[model samples]
Target: MIEVTEKAATELKTLLEQEGKPELALRIFVAGVACSGVQYGLALDDEVKEDDVTMESNGIKLVMAKDIERSFSEGSIDYIEDENGKGFLIRNPSAGGGCGTCGGCH
Candidate 1:
């Protein structure tokens, strides 16, 4: 199952509220794949497909395609703020490797 850190949940709530679509669920998916591993994607979606897996994490609703769920089965979504600024970070143990952008070749 996927988890969301408190900070991440709080940020997600703010973003949803700002979007004026609090009823929409956060959709997470695999956007692409490289030689290193998989890349992720996120968005707010109002429709849930038949093959979607829906769940609540840290009080926020999340949805994902069943076929893409395995890569995120044991991970947590986190919000990080540092010199680089603030953003959402997906910490998936099952992801195996880092993305190609981080000095890794695709």
Candidate 2:
């Protein structure tokens, strides 16, 4: 299952509050696959499709597409801060290099 860190959860809550969409769930999915690895996208969505997988973490609801669920199954989303800046990072141990069509990923 996907996990959300406390900091990430807090940030998500603040963003949702600012957007005035408290009912919206955080949607995460694989937007594309590249040579570096799979790219992830996130958004606040109020709609939940029939095939979507829903889970709650730190009191926040997360929705993901069923077809890409395995790509994020054991990953954790975290909010981090450093000298450079701050942003959300998805740490997925299963991710690997190369796009699926490149025949370079094994």
Candidate 3:
């Protein structure tokens, strides 16, 4: 199970509103190809895949694909905004023994 903080939930809500996609939900995705062993990806998806595990927390819907769900059983995603603007930052505990930002060939 994944957890979303109050700050993160608010950030997501803002994005959804801006995109004018009320049907969209936050999808927590992971891939094994970065310079590191695993990399995380997050996006607002309108459709839930068949192999996805869905959960709703803190008034936000979370979807994790089957392959990613195995490696990313838990993690935290936050919305960060600074001099560079706004973006989603994923803190994945499963990212172990990885290389650079690519998360590949670890």
Candidate 4:
């Protein structure tokens, strides 16, 4: 039940078009673990492993490994642009997470 914010969905679609990979799904994975909790990363992927969980958010396809799905079962993806710059971010309410950045670690 991961949700993609309107801004994030729009930006992701544009990126896919730019890369000529409009059909690729956004893949989410456990990049590492920090004091904030599990750190997740995103990428465009066409492959879905047997243990991968798939879903759609804001009309965008999303895929993640089964092991990491629970962490984001009720999360949302957002795009933020401010003084610090812009990037995608995953917001998981159930987890004590912070500082998961698409551009760089804060």
Q: Highest TM-score among the candidates is held by which one?
A: 4
Total clashing pairs for each candidate: 0, 0, 9, 0
**lDDT by residue (tens digit), candidate 2, 2-103:** 789999999999998999888999899888768868889888899999999999988789899987787778888899999999999888888875556867
lDDT per residue, candidate 4, 1-106, as tens digits?
Answer: 8899999999999999999988999999888887677778998999989999999988799999897876678989999999999999988887774566543444
Candidate 2 vs. true structure, TM-score: 0.85
TM-score, cand. 4: 0.87
TM-score list, all predictions: 0.86, 0.85, 0.79, 0.87
Per-residue C-alpha lDDT of model 3 across residues 11-101, encoded as one tens digit per residue: 8888788988867888876544655557777888988988888987788999878878788878787778899997778877877775556
Which regions of candidate 3 deviate over 4 angstroms?
A: 83-85, 99-106
The candidate scoring highest on lDDT is 4
Whole-model lDDT values for every prediction: 0.85, 0.87, 0.78, 0.88
- Displacement of residue 35 (Cα, Å) in model 1 is 2.8
User: What is candidate 4's CA lDDT for residue 10?
Assistant: 100
- Higher-scoring candidate on TM-score, 1 or 2: 1
Backbone-clash count (model 2): 0
Model 4 regions lying over 4 Å from their true place = 97-106
lDDT value, residue 66 of candidate 1: 86
Q: After superposition, how far is residue 33 of candidate 4 from its true place, in Å?
A: 0.7
Clashing pairs in 3: 34-102, 34-103, 34-104, 35-102, 35-103, 35-104, 36-99, 36-103, 36-104
